[model samples]
Target: MRIAQVCNVGEICGGTAACAWSITLAFPDVDHTVIFLSPPNSRTVEAFQHCQFHSAKSITDGMIRHLNVDLVILHNSTPNRVAQIRSTPSIQYHHSMGSRTAADVHLACSKWLHQRTPQSTQVLWQPTPIPIQRTDNPSRNAATSLRIGRICTPDDRKWPQSLIPLYERLAESFKNVEWEFIGAPGTLRESLQHACRGNARFITADVSARSRYWSWHALLYHHPTISESFGRTVAESMRCGTVPIVDRKGGFCEQIESGKNGFLCTNPDDFVAAIHQIQDRNHLSQLSQRAQDSSHEKCSLSIFRSRFLRILNQLSLGDSFDA
Candidate 1:
């Protein structure tokens, strides 16, 4: 079936754009078109040669109609903007906790989000493609310095305003650990550089590479100020078999079953203890395998395809959906 994935961001940077791109990749048999409300990034435009794209300042009913798509999926669109396409059969998708657009059939990306959303919304986990190469290091032993990574867009809003102290504490507690910060903001990186002198490595290059996700033995993530709606980074890390230690609030609580696949930290002390606990090579290996196994069950490509087809069937687009 022909589908139009409409998004507010033009670049494949944030979770909304990432999910749209992932959904496109998940359904290879379906014809997909991406509509970006903002002018798209040149690199992304060049890289995505397989799909048709539309870059516009605003989206309207006429614009969507012109695409001749069987379905229109709106990502993080404002309520007022969603009203413009009243005539179209569309799914208003919420990617953030802030999205409150009312629709007959809206979709939330996580169970946490679905619970908080209006009762009408359906939960649809974002599809994350598994890396073709397995990067799990089975030979890792107790002598190895556990590499813990933190990755996200270099935005202050995505970080805790006072995370320097936490980083310092983690650095002081484990001298042998390697702290890798991918896409850390400049000021944050400088502070971490100072506190974590030899123990830390701030990586500004190759932030989106799949290998980066798989390289980490564990992911240290905490955003007490801003809760993630679905925590795509945590999901991606899990897909790569990287155990994530994230804040116990927001969508993170849904992804991790503390002391199982991953750990959900409720406080700074909890974070430190969780990291220290994983120092055991045996425990780390078990959690990593469990995280990878759980990710396949939660967000794998096959699950996404089945859900997409189910949603299509519910929309009466089943006749057109060959898959």
Candidate 2:
């Protein structure tokens, strides 16, 4: 089957662009074309070399018809624009929070997001594919020093206003704890530097890279200000066997089972309590393994491929939708 994925492929890694790529890569047999709304950089061009790329400022029914694909997948498009397409069978793949498209069939990246979508809308759960494989054990040196880390883009909206206060509290509670912030910008790093007082290290790391999670015992994430539609980074960390202690909000709650695979915190004190529980080596190991297993079971590439193919079959793409 031929499919066209329309999305904004900006410089930032892993968002709608990554989701579109994952869906395309899932079906090797299907012909896929990516219609990037923004002009993609050289990195994006090299990364998505498997599929044909097209640059366009806006999407229209005429443009989609020109592609002559069996199906079209819309990502990060305006509601009115999404509703305007009438000739082609299209599906809106919602990736960001507060982004609702006017498509007949909607696919949300997490159960949390699926719930938030209007009950009237036909929304299906299509989780973001987390393609991480861990050959090594996820156990860490928790007895000596606890490595708490978080990975995200340098978006101020994702960071809580009370982040500095929360960091100070955590530093005071644990004597041997160190915090690492990956993908932090200079402005965010400056603020964290003042609060951490030499206890934190800010690194401008790639968001899609798995090596960033290796040294971390726990992914301590709290984004109370702006919730994620799908916590891709949190799930990725768990795939690497790093337990996530994230705020009990947004899609992060769906990825973690709370005290089983990982911990879900509501407040600063809750985060502290969760960290204290993982201080025990045995407990940490158990949670780490379970986190890895749960992540693989939930967001593995195989499951994503099956779900995507199933969606296409449901749409009556063709009789050869079996995979």
Candidate 3:
């Protein structure tokens, strides 16, 4: 079956774009096309060369009219595009496109997201593809330093802002732990860097935070201030067998069973307690194994293919896959 994946951002490597690209790579049998609304990044444009691409500055009526595909999957599409393609046999593959979006089917990445979305939505687990080249040792390498990491996006929406004081207290209290922030410079990073001004323990590297998942023994992402449509980074770290310390909110809460595969925190106090719980190497090792195992069970390629086909079957567009 011919499938078209539509997205707004093409240049930035955010979760939306990442999910769209992953779909293209996952399905080789089904004819796939990427319809990008914004000016696509050169790297991504080249990557999608194996398939077809239609990049435009705006989502126009002509662009909508030209998509001759059996199924249209909207992955982070603009409202205009959503409206333009409302008539097509389409489903929205979204993380945070809230209610009011009209579609034949709506696939949200997290249960919380699905719950908030219009009744048409269903939970669809996202799959992350292996990077083209092996990224820097994703696994923790330093024996002395208890490496901790999280994305410091420009907006500082990744984690709870209310936990800043507690985070500062911990950073100062623990000498052996290293904190790594891998996004645009933000106020929180600045504060953490200021609080830990004496040494390199407070690291602010502009690196692919996702690639460094394995390097971090644990991800402290408690108190997600903004409602996450899907917590891709949480699962990414879990896939690397890295335990995540996340709040009891968003999509992360759906995949995680507190004290089982990962730690689920209620607030800053609970978050700090959870961190201490996995301080022991043996205990941390057990959680890590379970995290990776859970990732494999929920987000593996085979499972992704199965879900993709199932959705197609529901649409009555089932074309057998070589997957």
TM-score of each: 0.92, 0.88, 0.85
Q: List model 2 lDDT by residue over 1-323, tens digit each.
A: 78888886544365677677767666778888998878987767876788898887778888878888888888857764444567777787776555555654677777777776662233443444544444352335523788889777655665545678888888888867878887666667777866777789877644344465766889988765778777777877887788999888888777789999999888898998999999887899999999989988887777877666667666776466667
Name the weakest run of 10 consecutive residues (lDDT summed) in model 2.
119-128
Tens-place lDDT per residue, model 3, 9-90, is: 7743567767776777678677888878777767567667777888775554455567767778877555654464644577
In candidate 1, which residue ranges exceed 4 Å CA deviation?
Answer: 99-104, 132-143, 205-207
Model 2: pairs clashing at backbone N, Cα or C within 3 Å: none
Worst 10 residues of 3 by lDDT: 198-207
Q: Candidate 1, residues 70-150: lDDT per residue as tens digits?
A: 788888787655444655578878877664444446888888888877633588988988754444533233336788888
Model 1 alpha-carbon miss at residue 177, Å: 1.0
Give each model's clash number: 0, 0, 4
Candidate 3 residue pairs in clash (backbone atoms < 3 Å):
138-214, 138-215, 139-214, 160-223
Off by over 4 Å in 2: 12-14, 80-83, 96-101, 119-144
Rank ordering of all candidates by TM-score, starting from the highest: 1, 2, 3
Per-residue lDDT, model 2, residue 48, is 77
| Order by lDDT, highest first | 1, 2, 3
